[model samples]
Target: MTTLDPYLAARIHLLSGLDWDGIADPEARSRFDEYGRDPGEWTMPDVDVVDHAAPGPHGDVTVRVYTPPAPAAGALLWVHGGGFWGGDLDMPESSVVAAELASRAGIVVASVGYRLAVDGVRYPVPLDDVVAAWEWFVRERPAASPVCLGGASAGGALALAAAIRLRDAGSLLPAGLFLAYPVVHFPVPALDDATAAAMRSLPPLLRFPPSLIEEMFANYVGRLGDLPPLATPGHAPLGGLPAVHLVSCELDDLRPSADLLARQLAEAGVEVRAQLAAGMPHGHLNRTPTLDGVDRSLAHFAAGLRALNGAGEVPPDVA
Candidate 1:
């Protein structure tokens, strides 16, 4: 079996002995706050970043757009993941990924700041914000440019649901989809024996057990039963969607969910190109881009973006 990346394994090893569930809230927050601090250096390629307000049903949704100096290969509407409640435009998964994709793939990226599932906000609220941002981005971009939709973790669920919505509504659809370690299932499918064994070595904080999965969904949709299909899109019909590039992390509990969705997509006749990020954990994109795994994941997504516009491949330097 492949081992965890040494850097990540060392980090996880430090927390392996901690009783994550037993820790007091305040203490746990204090101990883990360092993980969220911005990396001191930001040595990414030069790109023009701007934020714009896109009209949504509830209010204006903010979209951070990144533009490359060169002509763009295509446009991507990107979403960040936080279990549907925690991420923002400033997170590395949002800003760093957008900047890298724009500069490396020569693509314009619109990172959506969707409403989180908190303070009574629930299903369809975050989805609506994403849809609104997508429509606005589509209208703003050149008609000839190919546009793709992408997200990581919960954001993947939103991106796929939005794609399905656009298809059913007879609206313009994206040219492709780029999903990274997406948690698209309700129960989050059971892991295979190999994956289960691999997960045993991870810290409690790194794991997503069944109970945690249920709690996350409960917080997301209020009630799990009689839910809208889009709430857990893995069960929804995935036919007629555009080409998909799915990245499943090797050691993630949610890897099974991504695997299930890949099968569903293929059975539904969608073109799917899936890769397992070896020796990686879920949300590795949240790490500093200097990490080898993070750069590899970014390159995989950038290559997919370039392919969406028939741009051949990512440049060697970018790759």
Candidate 2:
């Protein structure tokens, strides 16, 4: 049996008994806040990090740019995941991944700070922000620079949706896509027998049941009925898109969705490479990069970005 990493198992044990459904609860929030506190040991490499305002229909969207010291191999427009309700550019999944990719892959990384699905905000708003930021980034970068689009969780949904919009508009499509444990299916696919059995041991906070997944989508689009394909691109047509590099967490409830997407991509004649992060749970990228699994996940993304620039092979450290 594939076991949970000891470090993550211990952390999950500490977070046990807290109701993930009550994330808005003061106690739940407090516990999560404490758990999310990061040590200051992790440092960014020698790279220029800057924040810029990209014009958006709703307002100015924040796009954090990370530039490597040497010439960039390519560029990536990254999106962070929070089930459509939470997450920001400051999250480790966003900022740290951008910094690591910028240094490790020798590429420019633009992390988008799209509006969350809260208050009266609904579908197409966050998508608009990402699209706007992508357009701005494309204009700002060199004409010949190869650019890719990537995201994790809900951010992955947005990234794929944005790509669909670009493709439909006959606009420039990304050279490739890097999706990390993406939640692209609205209903979220059902897990297989072995995977389902494995998920039974996960902490409540780490499990994404079907009901919870549905509720998350409802909150994002304002209703579950007649959902937009772009909002959950797994069921949408997936032809003519660029090559994809997808990471699926072994212990994640959302792995089924990512697996289905891989098959769909193949059926649609799109080149795709999917790798499972063994012994890892969903949102592993949110953890400190010092962890072996986190570093490997980042390296997978770095290798994908490097491939876009015609780099020969995956680096020795990726596995």
lDDT of 1 by residue, 1-319 (tens): 8578776665554454556565666766665554433335668678999999999998999999999887565899999999998999999899999999898789899999999999999999999999999999999988777999999999999999999999999999998899989898888888889879888878787788888889889999999898789998898889999988888888888898999998899999998887787888888888766777777788888887877677775323220
lDDT of 2 by residue, 1-319 (tens): 7667776665665566777667888887887777654433588788899999999999999999999888565899999999888999998999898899888889899999999999988998999999999999999989789989999989988998899889999999999998999899877778888888978987788888888898899999989988999989887789999988888888988888888998899999998877778888899899767787888788888887887788746433221
Question: Which sections of candidate 1 miss by over 4 Å?
Answer: 19-42, 314-319
Worst 10 residues of 2 by lDDT: 310-319
Question: Which 10-residue window of candidate 1 scores lowest in summed lDDT?
Answer: 310-319
Error of 2 at 111 (Å): 0.3
lDDT of all the models against the reference? 0.86, 0.86
Q: Report lDDT (Cα) of residue 294, candidate 1.
A: 79
Candidate 1 local lDDT, residue 291: 79
TM-score of 1: 0.92
